[model samples]
Target: MRLRRALLVSCAALALAASALAQGWLDRVPPEIHGEVPARAPAGEPLTVRFSASEPVAYTLAYGGETWEAVVQNLFVLRVRPGEHALVVTATDGAGNETRVAYTVTGVGAPAAELHVTERARAGDPVSVRVTLPEPPAEVVSVRLGGEALPTFAADAVEGGAGRSVVALGAVPLSAAGTLDVEVVVRDPFGRERTLKRALEVAAEARPVQELGLTPEALGALSDENREAEAAALREAYRGAAPDPLWREPFILPTEGVNTSAFGLPRRYAVSGAVSFHQGADIAAPQGTPIVATNDGVVLLTGFYPIKGGLTVIDHGGGVSSLYFHQAVMVVTPGQRVRRGERIGEVGSTGLATGPHLHWEMRVNAVPTDPLAWVGRLLP
Candidate 1:
């Protein structure tokens, strides 16, 4: 009986020993970490490091005298000074098995400058192009869209004020329907020249056509000399733009009236069979309706003309200008500062028109755009 009892005890001990050995083997396998640390990063900028483990793990990251602990699923972000750094990570699994990883990261200066532009725009729409650099450039040599120079101004950078931003305003031509190339040339503070390039895709816009009949007096006013003179005056008014924006709020409508003629409409005169696209919107109102300034700006020009009648041109700065035409009386004069919604004129049919109305127009960098788009909104 004693021998049989001893044999049972020995068998039980062997079974317990086998179970212990199996558990030890399973605990020896540590969790595997999967990820890569960037060898180089932008100096002083936040660098994000993402990693995962084969199994759930508690991870600890050590660098630059700082320690961070979280689950392996969470990402690690660090901002290292402009130099080399040693990053060490330790991961521990549920079974007490641990794994360690180390990486060497180098922090470098800012990357090459970049140019940003609107990727897509509709024909006759305004587009904004921007150039970003680590430091402000000494001079912006030129900003060109489709090989034409554009007016540029300084603006706040998009990257949390870490760099400088130069902005240029442009418009897609009413007839353009393809990709347009943009080029920017700037001189760095060190006097080194840098050129950046980008492309903008312009979509076609289909505008409606309108036919109208004009009296002999109106037809006579549309002479070649009158048109050329009006064109020259407008060019001179838009030649010098303020380096900054003057409007402090959203733009408003110049007057309240029915929109008789929309912008970009092909107007065909029945009297002479002449066609021309309307550069502005015609708002029909009673004679002597109050007209207000679209935004805060300086009155650049106010005078009577053959085509525009009592016209007032306001420079809202930053390549934006507003025009109010066909007015019976002009309340503002050149070099006078006007505020948004302030009275500037009275509606009339003094110009080449069939009835009393106000022809309101808005231009960006000398390019006529849809004025209604600017109403109730602020632009860059």
Candidate 2:
């Protein structure tokens, strides 16, 4: 009789537990919103929306005066329209419990122009590229021309609220006629919505500059031995690999002196009016003038040369490098560490220079950019 009583007690406990489990099932499941959809309209060109949820929920999405019954909440993408939109989401649990939430949709402006890219000019020639937009967004993050991503530019009040950026290729040779594709991306401040796409076209080639040749007699002035040694030194200085960071610090002037020649200046040598371009700036200073390092850098080169005189080149972490020419003496040797403003040399005309001065050149990925624009503004 006692055994029968114990058996009855166990059966009663199991039934009670089953009833409790069914009652508390909803408590274990929390509210989830996973489905995402583009709040912007299809007129915005690149707008898309997405959606997600924890489990299958009987739901409906209301937008643009239309309702969509959502059998299962996975990912639903929508192309929306311009102007304000009301989003109503209704969800019902398996147990018949129901919930709803609302959000707003702000339409994106139409593309003012397709992202357009054309060869404006050539290296050493003036290049102009035109970008057309259907309707300009409030701001432009950046426009990629060719294969390069340039700085973000802002629009003026008159530019249809669209912005532009221009670059000078300057004296660099191209492998061949090139095709360029431009990509422009605009973002809406709300909801981190962004539109990105590319525009492609063949670039119009600029007229090639005629090459001026000098006879062997004219080149006799420079000693072949001296020129070979100088070439070897420069090659050694540049052959090593350097990292090109995604972001770079603004350049700084290595030293202060009188600016004698600006970059890209057409020049006539020996009163013949035979033109040449000044590739770097000449900063004339007194002999023994302290030549400081431009930024924190490692000395890649410290040597004397027949063409450059006594020169030093500093590799500043990034692909950026600075060259200081016409030094009377070099204080730092190759492989030495130097800080910004650290004296690396004394200025003197040692190479093919007219006077005591420092020829300073700033190179980005081996390409020359405007040094003044980087040096003039005091760094923050």
Candidate 2 lDDT over residue span 1-380, tens digit each: 99999999989977876775477453335447654554545444444445555645677778678777855644445556577777777776565555677877777654444443333333322122334334434334555555565433222212333344222122122321454445555543443334455433334443323233434443443577977887687667766624422112344676678987765555554444356555566788889888888777788898877677888988764345678888999999888878877889898988777679888876654555335534643221
- After the best TM-score superposition of candidate 1, give how far the Cα of residue 117 lies from its true spot, in angstroms: 2.8
**In candidate 1, which residue pairs get closer than 3 Å at backbone N, Cα or C atoms, i.e. clash?**
none
Cα deviation in Å at residue 334, candidate 1?
A: 1.0
User: Would you list the C-alpha lDDT of every candidate in the order shown?
Assistant: 0.80, 0.58
Model 2: lDDT equals 0.58
**Candidate 1 lDDT tens digits, 289-375:** 999999999998888899889899999988889999889999989889999999999999887878899999898877888788778
